[model samples]
Target: MSIPQFDWEACINLMLQAMQGAQLGLLRLLSWLHLARDIDGQPAWPFALRLSGEVLLIDHNVVRALVSALGCLVAALLLLALAVAWRRRRWLLLGLAVALVLLAPWPDQALLTTAATPTSFHTSPERFSAAGIVRGEQLYRQQCIACHGADGRGNTPLGLSLEVAPPNLSSGLLWRRFDGDLYWSLRHGKGGMPAFEASTSPADRWALLDYLKANAAGVGVTDTGSWPRPVALPDMALDCRASTVTRLDQWQGQRIRLVIGGTAPLPSEDPRLQSVLLGGQASGAVGAIACASHEATALRAIAILTGVPEERLAGTELLADRDGWLRARNSSGQWSQQDMLCRSPLASGSPVAQVAQVGGSGLDQLIAAMDEEPVRFIKGGFVH
Candidate 1:
């Protein structure tokens, strides 16, 4: 009889599979605890490694419950082994237990002392719609303008009089905090700030946050020439000629060229984009779709995103991606890639190189780049 050879390749494959499973389990646990870093936008390791389709369904709640039950079973088995070791006076088992105890992760006292909001309360129910932002602006004027100032820089006389100065809401601070934490602060108040729980409803507080986010995005771009985070184009009702679609969101799955002032001649029609003229007479223009009676509230919200006053918004042109994300802005002259905000990491080549390669207009190059690398936004944050 011939001697059987060991299946080294099969053994190695099994070991690798086991390691990958362990790593995936650890990642799920971290995500459940809200301790996992946002890796959706990253192009590097672990993030770049995608699981096979077979494992994708592991995210389902039923599968997750099964995994949790398996963990509990393993813990029970460990306890059983410990009891057996003690009862049997097994030196090796006791030694292993001591080693595990030495290597176990322990909570840091310093970190423990610091109070943290519950991880369960991380997301906000607010949708950050145009109407919500408009309401938010009204609330800001009523409740926050006294201390935060009209610019949200916290430079008012009332703000200066406080023992602890109000924080600059226009800065990147708004992007750093979780919505739930901000809501908690608004409800309970902090330091010199007064609580609004009595005066403002939950919906009102959320709307206020939406307004602040919009204001911050505009201010950040104005002050630093860059967006603090990716901003979604506020959704609004639209009057499209010869089209049944009555809302801006209905145009999803297609890119949009939004013209604010409508003073200049419309750009050459491109099959790739839908051009909608804002605040202009609907002359039944062939290439461009004219939206009539441009609602002031919608225009105001958009003006905030452009970092310009409503009166100056006439000449502005904005670009929104297929996903309804506001991508670029041009207030004067022709549009260029330099005007793009929330540029994608996956976009290939420098703007100059792209211009040479495409040999097209600046707007065309920007559209191409946007198609190449789509933006990924999640829960008020960019994946990248």
Candidate 2:
């Protein structure tokens, strides 16, 4: 008799494939489990879709509760079945015990009791008026539908192209977020979601927020207002050259023109020019900073401050006004859409119409031109 040759490599590959398939099967089952209203503790809509990229729709608290409950149920049922089988002292009793174990509903019930915490925001009541919704719907059709879909389900081709698929607006998980938080996020722009502050007015932003909320879970707008308007939006700062922290509010009243930059050697003749253009005199601005610096600490700090993921920091130039509202943003195509900064403000009376890449004489000319306008922001240092 001849010994058969074994294909160990092929067997290993097949086993790996099987394991992967099993994981996918488990994911699909969990996705369905997440769809249950009781488990998530919110209306099921967007997050009700299948799991993607190994992420879970449910939060840690819910997952922990479900696992603990399932563990107890399995243990209890198994013990009861085994005890019955032993007491009966019969093989038929053992079979019945196995059947009872198989029929246990603990896992399903555990999944049902799991809770979810959705995103939240601070918003005003007046923003949810009937007129606001109408304007928001129009804006949705014009600007949002390309990615979010007609049904606000985020099923469009553009949505699929995002690193994180655009979440369904109707999803219970998404609804947990406050309208103000969403508005702020939309204003600053993060990842695939562009900064609409450049294109959408503050009131219109509120309108869109109202529209989305109304559509989600079929909720109606309320007449009472709660959240107060902010005194000033939060300021942002990043470490610049010479170890100084460049706060956006510092340039509040200046004619600043920030550019998406990288490290450049300073001119030996002017040591103050650490890659700065016009040296704060001609431009009436404090020069510039490299967008993607070697300063990881600065980058991380900006991420924490802005609530923007660290991954989106590269190749973005963020601009702001004296009052701390991000006035404009420019980007190089190196990073993903979600990482891009806000575009120029869309307010009709905004100073800058489009984000300009001015330098040298062009920067000097823009600064001189902007000098005619009254300064609305100031962190104080302005050179005569």
Candidate 3:
């Protein structure tokens, strides 16, 4: 039987499609694997998901298929080139070329970057108002209130049996925790909960947080807005600290305890020389003090130092608190609800924000605004 003519684009497309199909099948297969908790000492979430990807990658049958496709391509090319040089008939030469090209070995290029399909979910949602409270409430009512409850209580009949208790969104402990941590939970979805990362856009998630913060049923970071008469609220202690010590290895992970009233270093002993631990808290002895939230602080520092532009900072928060949670965030200044909804003390009441705004995405925009002069953020922590 005559071999088919060499079609480069078609062959490439087919190989790419096969690789993508195999990968997608592999992901679907993994979704079936009911992994028990705690495979290694580490958390089950990262281990199982990552391991699934690794395992799917090593399937020999899939590997063989990829190899076979490559081999065919090489063989076809060689035969086609030879036939063309010899002035052979178009159909015959092309067929022989394809047959020969089929002998080369390589993996499909399409498989390199796996595209995760967006997840779809359906639920009755709550709606909120413009200043952003009701809007957040509405979003929670739709996405979370079913499990957490309209009251922010965890007595949902459907969620009772779950090993992981649905957190009280209005609880003081929950709201006080970093917003990023809350955001992460919503995005990744712990335990049996499905991941809402792809489903719930970041802006909507924040709005939900705002509602949880505002109507937290008398919970959340104790809003000391109004104090008792005759006794004023303790002033927010000036946190301005200048440390020149560079070798961060000494006190990285330890939670450097700071007395809320006075930022004093405990005399009896502070831990020394720790790596930048995930949850940055100095146990009894060892400790270091970094930004409260990496998202709020880290990216800003990087931008100040690197001269990255404001617009370039991905909506992802960079500065992390001692617990590695995003207490504050340097979200994308582009079209974020916060610009219209919330105010930042750091932003100095201005909506236009930037991280590395000098050199990064905002370069063009900032450049146009300069009045025959340029400014540096060095004076403002890392920015100034």
Candidate 4:
């Protein structure tokens, strides 16, 4: 009689079918376990990974299914080898196979594949302007307010449902992150939060950054995202050249120009800035104040006033109108509208000097564009 052929292919097929059936059985058990745990009738599972723009549900059922599939496949192969070894009475082969299967290192390794995929995305160029901040504020109200609260304090009822509470955007912890980092976090949310990349536009993302910066600086930005009337200029003395404690109110009736001192010539020293001032003087309605304060303090003050980032404050100057309303802001030294007020390119390592203009205008065009309304300052104008 011919011995029945031991078909290796049929044995392998039977092992695979057994593995699949075991995996399905394990999955159903997991589902039953989940249903048993839902005493309050909320979502049965409390964990999720936020993907590109959607929540990747990772409830007990999913985790159990994956674990069961991997465990079943490994067990099936090991059992097949052990069966063959037992049939041949090879004890050493069975023992070695069991040892190797027990020592497999799948659980100890980090989730390297998952980590590599999420952080590969990029964000758009940052936009740092007052308008951007206002628009961002509006977007925040519509989308983020439900979780982060109207003040960005993350104290809302919905926020309490998360395993990890959402971070307060206005806190100092977020200060270390730049606009790019902020954009990335917003586009690809972590932990329990959902991603906003698909729901929010690139422009709106930049605006949200501007708004966050402004909010962090303690600006009392309203929840609706409207530009608050220019806060009252604090009574900080301008400390100009040849003038002591020069208050901002001194420039109230005429356009006030505050040029933060830098290597670029002081408004009083540079012929270009002077010529622009002369042009504004010709208009009979120009007031310029040169602030020689420390660069760090000046930057903070400007950030509070206009919501512009400090790095973006390079070059150019600040122009506020007669009613103490901010009219136009320049990013770099080049002023297109003013013919003679252009900032001369500074030689490398040029020394900075403090100079002040109690009354002048290097930006007549900007001054003219100022709102022609009576000055109205918000209460508690600026923080000390």
Highest TM-score model number? 1
- Misplaced by over 4 Å in model 4 are 1-127, 219-384
**What TM-score fits each model?**
0.66, 0.27, 0.26, 0.32
Question: Least accurate stretch of 10 residues (summed lDDT) in model 1?
Answer: 106-115
Q: Give the worst 10-residue stretch by lDDT in candidate 3.
A: 227-236
Arranged by lDDT, best first: 1, 4, 2, 3
Backbone clash count for every predicted candidate, in the order shown? 2, 15, 64, 4
Per-residue lDDT of model 4, residues 307-359, tens digit only: 55555554446554454444445546554343221121211221111111222
Better candidate number, 3 or 4, judged by lDDT? 4
Best by lDDT: 1
lDDT of 4: 0.44
For candidate 1, what is the TM-score? 0.66
Better of 3 and 4 by TM-score: 4
Q: Model 3, stretches more than 4 Å misplaced?
A: 1-60, 85-93, 100-142, 148-156, 159-202, 205-384
TM-score attained by model 4: 0.32
Candidate 1, 45-121: lDDT as tens digits: 12323322122122333334434444555555585588685876566666665555544432223111122432212
Rank ordering of all candidates by TM-score, starting from the highest: 1, 4, 2, 3
Report the number of backbone clashes for model 1.
2
